[model samples]
Target: MQRFLPLIIVLVLVGVFLRMMTLEGRNPNEIKSVLIGKPVPEFTLPGLLEEEADLTNAYFNREEPVLVNFFASWCVPCRAEHENLMKLAQEHGVTIVGVAYKDRHADALEFLDELGNPFSRTALDRNGRLAIDFGVTGVPETFVVDADGIITYRHWGPVVGDGLEKAILPALEEAR
Candidate 1:
């Protein structure tokens, strides 16, 4: 029985090692949102550029797919993907709703001034409450919502490089 105990311990250790190996090389940026297949949370946020206006799901017309992107002035990845966002807004004429999460109004304004804003409507999430409702972990996360107001897909990290062609474009089509 003592000799068999040593063999069993060795087998257990080998199994544990193999299981850990399976986790390696996995993409850490991929986060499947619990909100997928669900309706976007309803909230009213102050406009990023204007104080008199408010942004709410009520304004979302159930006739076109839209991109809801959470970004911050301080997030480097957000800056990197700004151009692609512009392409979506101008080239494809896609509607993009931007959320400036946890950034000062002045800073967000400055960032947009430097990068050229591409948002159809920009909301200011000063306390990040809206981002919390959306289950956002960090800045530069994007969600594709169908015309029915259902969230179809979520993309973590910056959507640039081949991500625009391979993942983002396809998801937008699916949402439509």
Candidate 2:
């Protein structure tokens, strides 16, 4: 019985993991962020565009909520969510700050040129330092920061499908 104890534990652990994965309405990509309900981390980043100014935490301390999106030109899911981000900025008047995660300035510029720039201010996270501070798991994660600069919500993965209408928009409203 003692020799079989390890095997039983492993099997039980595997079963629990599988059950969690199969849970109804559980989004595999949605990794709960530790920064939610906390103040955003302080950091400064260079502008992705030549004429744009540097982006900092101070920009998020405004009267309205802001969306900070982490994306990379090489990420396919980032491309998929670009249109929805544009709609949020243009049609809904949402303020979005973009962070180009571990991407070259030129490539990021080309990406924005091809797919219209929706961000009010774009920052370059060439070393992924900012992403780490924000507890970002990957490119295409977005955080909704409230007026007082507290992160109210985090959406992991591309904001596609009904994500904007159902998740992102409601988060922004609640933050307001």
Candidate 3:
């Protein structure tokens, strides 16, 4: 029995590790952010629209929580999430700030025109500097920022189906 004790402990450790990997709401592809519970990184990006002012970290200084979405005109998942974004802004009156990551202004404009512009302010991250600061790994990533400019939640993929109700709405309420 003493000789078998080591093998039993090893098996228990392996089982625990595997259980963690398969935990609910844990996605193998998700890249966890280091910025959660921290203030948003300071950034200044040109507005996607020529007539609009530049978007800066100061835009997040508000009395309400804001959704910061990283998207691209070329990303198909971004299109899929557009409807939820619009619903959040229009129906729920959630303020959203869009960062167009590594996309041309014209293409972004066309994409918004085709779907509908949900962003109260849209900025261009043409060089991906802002996205990098935000620790964005891909298109359609979103961060929920509280009134104090701290990141409360991060959604790694397109906000579709249950993502809006289950995750985003709850995060927003918590931020409030």
Candidate 4:
């Protein structure tokens, strides 16, 4: 057994190396979300537009499907997805809600002012607790929720390039 131990270790290392090589060519954002097909986590947070106003999960209870986007002012990729979000909100008549994850209120407001606010209701998730409930691995994640408040699709990274037109738009149309 002692003589074979070296062989066993070499084989284990080879297996690990091969597995990593498989992921090397894959995009990290292609990681599937665990929250897909589950009901959205419930929470009540302060509205981003007004400190006193409430932004709750109840906002998703509507006739139309809502896109709940989790972003941070500090995230550069979040800026990349802004125009696509605006198109969905204004041109497509979709309800886009933002959860300001782990960002200062002033910074978030400044981000909106500079980038153009597309969200109908932006929820302030100051402590990132709400993001945890949604199983967020990082900022700039977006979830598509049906009118029944069930999460149908979760895009793991900033929706840009073909992401918005391919993944997000199709999922939203199906949800609607």
Candidate 5:
């Protein structure tokens, strides 16, 4: 019994060490970028306006560069970023698409109405499948896809006021 006690203690210590190492090395903020310089993933979701609006076909047409933003009514950061999106739509001629991540259609509509709808089109990702395809970890993630349908830049977390002028606009210009 004494010999086994020592072995158990050693095993527990090793487990603790491993867990500590993993926690120290892993960064929650360090989200990996995907589809960079590649064609964006093809997906179809319901538009926010209609129960059956075809978002997939509309997105695939290369009329202009597209900004796809993953957001939810429940996300505070999304509300924080909403104004920036609205400004981009109104001022910059930038087409913005919203994906209502894991949210109900009615709630998403209410959020848009309350915040001012900036999105040229809003897609319903009721199950988060499209969000997963886009490598979204959480709400308020944004992706910029060029007119040629290539994904150029991805921003994790909320798109702050400065982020639009600094990062998003430049990428859109380059893609154009």
Candidate 6:
């Protein structure tokens, strides 16, 4: 029994060490940056326009830069960032595209109508595959893609006040 006691202790210690190591290296908010200096992921989603516009083809191929915002009608932070996006879209000539993350089409349309449709094109990501491809762990994430479809900047959480001009715009300008 005495000899076996040390073996059990060693096994338990090994298990604890492995668990601790896993936790130490784990980052809950970690998102991979795939769009940085790379072509935007190809996605052709249905738009909110009357003509059912294609977002990836129409916007990515354009000569001007574009902003892509991932949001959901159920996300509260998205509401907080709505005004800032609206102002940015109106003031700057930056093209703004919205992806409704894992939401019903009707709810997304209603949310836009109530909050003000600031997006040039709004796409419904009902299955959340696009959001996952973009490495989005939460809503209200924004990405700035240059004219060449290269992702220039990414912002997580609610963007407010000078965040648009201060952080996002500078990156867009640099990419330009």
Best by TM-score: 3
67-152 in candidate 4: lDDT tens per residue? 99999999999999999999988898888899899999999999999999889888789999999999898989999999988999
Pull out the clashing pairs in model 3.
none
Candidate 1 contains a number of clashing pairs equal to: 0
Clashes of 2: 0
TM-score of each: 0.86, 0.88, 0.91, 0.84, 0.80, 0.78
Whole-structure CA lDDT of model 2: 0.94
Supply candidate 6's per-residue lDDT for 85: 88
Tens digits of per-residue lDDT, candidate 6, 1-176, equal 99899999999999988786678645446565766777788777877656666666446766778889999999999999999888888887667889999999889989998999888888988898888778787998998888877788788778887887777888768767
Candidate 6: where are CA atoms >4 Å away? Answer: 1-32
lDDT of 5 at 140: 88
- Candidate 3 lDDT by residue in tens digits, 1-176: 99999999999999999998999978988989999999989988999988889999998888999999999999999999999999999999999999999999999999999999999999999999999999999999999999999999999999999999999999999999
- Full-model lDDT for every candidate: 0.90, 0.94, 0.94, 0.89, 0.85, 0.82
lDDT of 5 by residue, 1-176 (tens): 99799899999999988786689645456576756887877777767897448688346459688998999999999999999998999998789888999999899999998999998888899999988888888998998888888888888888896888788889888878
Lowest-sum lDDT 10-residue window in model 6 = 24-33
Model 6 quality (TM-score):
0.78
lDDT of 4: 0.89
Better of 2 and 5 by TM-score: 2
List pairs with backbone clashes in candidate 1. none
Q: After superposition, how far is residue 164 of candidate 2 from its true place, in Å?
A: 1.2
Query: How far is each candidate from the true structure, as Cα RMSD in Å?
Result: 2.9, 2.4, 2.0, 3.0, 5.6, 5.3
Give the CA lDDT, 0 to 100, for residue 53 in model 6: 69
Pairs in clash, predicted candidate 6: none
